[model samples]
Target: MTDTFVALSDPTRRLLLDRLSEQGGLTLSELSEDLPMTRQAVAKHLAVLESAELVASERDGRCKRHYLNPMPLAKMAKRWLVRFEDVPLGSLSGFHAAPAIRPAHHP
Candidate 1:
């Protein structure tokens, strides 16, 4: 969905997603330490990602660790993106192979 794409378009957010994907999960502090932004800013970004359902977090003892929630994206892609791939074979190339006797409206 547009929300997921918009959330992922930011370099900082993408990096956060990558970190969560690679490491499974990370506390806000862990993610903020290596980045240039403040902890608050990271939380703000995470908030957007959370609303988009692109990320999820859980409180672990005293720390809230963020994790990648890819199911929404997987479902969205299956509904929105895969349809393009399933289009009838020649649909895209139809214009290029127009018949020699063109239809009145086509010419």
Candidate 2:
């Protein structure tokens, strides 16, 4: 979706998504702890990701824990990237396998 691409355009948001993928159900404070920006700034990035359905949150007691929602990204890849999967680009300089971009086997 357009929102997903928009949300992924920012490196910060991508980093946030990466963190969530690495550790799901993290509080905003935990998510922002290692970042150089204030918690509010991180929250703003999270807001955009949430708008794009790239992130989901749930209230747990007094804390709202954030999680990475990969479905939007998988849908996007299925829509756009699947077409290029069989293309041979090995001759291109520096081309290599990117595990991060590869979808996991579901079956």
lDDT of 2 by residue, 1-107 (tens): 88998999999999999999999999999989879999999999999999999999999999999999999999999989997788788755689867677677998
**Number of clashes found in candidate 2:** 0
Each candidate structure's count of clashing pairs: 0, 0
lDDT of each: 0.87, 0.93
Candidate 2 lands at a TM-score of: 0.81
User: How do the residues 1-107 of candidate 1 rate in per-residue lDDT, one tens digit apiece?
Assistant: 78988897899999988888888678989889778889999999999999999898899998898999988779888988898887766776544665599567854
User: Which residue runs of candidate 2 sit more than 4 Å off their true CA positions?
Assistant: 89-107
Poorest 10 consecutive residues by lDDT, candidate 2: 90-99
**lDDT agreement of model 2 with the native:** 0.93
For model 1, what is the error of residue 10's alpha carbon versus the real structure, in angstroms, after optimal superposition? Answer: 1.4
Single out the weakest 10-residue window by summed lDDT for candidate 1: 90-99
